[model samples]
Target: MTAERGVHKPNLLVLVGPTAVGKTRLSIEIAKSCSCEIISGDSMQVYRGMDIGTAKITPEEMQGIPHHLIDVLDPEESFSVAYFQKVCRSLIPEIASRGRIPFIVGGTGLYVESVCYEFQFTEAGADEAFRQEQLRFSEQFGPEALHAKLTEIDPETAAKLHPNDQRRIIRALEVYHLTGTTLSRQLESQTKASPYNLCIIGLTMDRQLLYNRIEARIDEMVQQGLVQEVKSLLERGCSRSLVSMQGLGYKEIAEHLLDGLPLEDAIMKLKRDTRRFAKRQLSWFRHMKDIHWIDVTRGENFPDHLADIRAIIAGKFGIPLEYNYKH
Candidate 1:
């Protein structure tokens, strides 16, 4: 693609990476430089009381820049990509109207991509009869049976989705009944075109280094009372199966706490799962062909990396990225 194709779009500085890769710090710098507001892309970070486990940034870390969409959702309330799209859509334009960039930053690939691609969503009215039929099918025939049925109807989507990914499976069947369009077709329609001009910035490090950082971050979280955070959520009556609990560290700790696994064992599992999660995140972003990759391996030279980032944004997205003479 021509430089103009990369350079002329309005700036939505999306800084994403695997967990604990320092996306937060870099994002603060980027947001400050571009006179931008940061919108979160982390799915778990939206929960109101789940701060420690979510590794949420404190007020001090924010460095006085405005942030949106963090700590807004109740843990018990269901959050979907559609909801996130609505929030981002509402915020990005508002930021733009003020002549500031909207920097979408975090580690959640699906949440980030859904907004960046402007994936169209179809409004499907439920057919109660058909919905009841599928619920009965799942009850008597089991989730696998329901998954098999979805496979017959939408093989492509099923190929990537897990058989136990019941929520997505049920959604697929729901769409099939409600709109008479297969889940695959709805996704196809959602791909019609994206609304915003987005600049994707992917952060990276050596695999071993990233994994080490993730484990270290987990250790830090444990010290910072992540277990207490999860315990508090349980007190709030969120079940283990809830989406919030499915988050990497929370799930393992919950299992250990409730099921008799030693705390060390739980922490070990948490660390391992996080590494696996980082791997999956890398796999997910592998096909994101438009991202500009930034590999920050050296510990020092923050300013050098920041400058390189600013130049890339200015050259690629027509934004005048500011930088401190010393900082």
Candidate 2:
């Protein structure tokens, strides 16, 4: 759409991929070239002091490009898709107002899609008593039992969510209890039209190569003091039960530290879980429409890959190969 200054600005330029797929560096380069600000769509990166496990980009690595939504929450605080959608919808226009593109960059599929489709959440707020009831039921009967309850009521939504994803399971149940409607059905009724002109780019590599990258990245995180990072968070009063600590790396490490599991086993579990997470991410993106996939494995040279991506950006979104960075 046209901005007040008569410049055309796409509502958003989204770059999404599985974890450890080189989204960070490429996003930085794209942001630099397009004069855009980066807004992280990652759920884990929103928590402060969750650097190593989340693979958060350091200030130096950001190369002076503005980024939003990272380090914005405490580990104990709760965040939701509704909140993410609200903040991003507001930020996109503001970024465009300053004559800069807004780039939604991360692997959090739900967060990205909520903004892209402009989901209208129902008015039913959290039912604290019901939530605590579900929490206690899960503690007493186990997560599967709790998930089974959801399956009986809303099998379609439960089919998409993992049994161990307690927060979402509880949320889905809460929505059902409060509104007498399944979350999936409610979402299906909302309008899917995005207010902005959206350009979505997805990155992928060979399956074997992607798995290797996930393994290597986990090893790198260990070298980067991931255990110590989790320990520091715990020492600072973050609990294992906090949703932030349930992230791939942090949760596995927490199991090691708290449940007396061996460190090596925890590391192995972390690697396996990350691989599964990447696969799930890919599955989510595949179901989305209008993604222009860029196969990074097709080229060995980083510069060549960057050039191809730039060409796609220019051709699809009308962004130039070079633009001044907004200070």
Candidate 1 lDDT, 255-275, residue by residue in tens: 777888899999998888678
Summed over model 1, clashes come to 1
Name the regions of candidate 2 deviating beyond 4 angstroms: 1-10, 323-327
Choose the strongest candidate by TM-score. Answer: 2
lDDT for 155 in candidate 2 is 93
Q: What is the lDDT of candidate 2?
A: 0.85
**Over the full model, what C-alpha lDDT does candidate 1 score relative to the true structure?**
0.79
Q: Report clashes for each candidate as comma-separated counts.
A: 1, 0
The lowest-lDDT stretch of 10 consecutive residues in candidate 1 is: 1-10
Clashing pairs in 1: 7-316
RMSD of 1: 4.0
RMSD of each: 4.0, 3.3
Model 1 residue 116 distance off true place after TM-score fit, in angstroms: 1.2
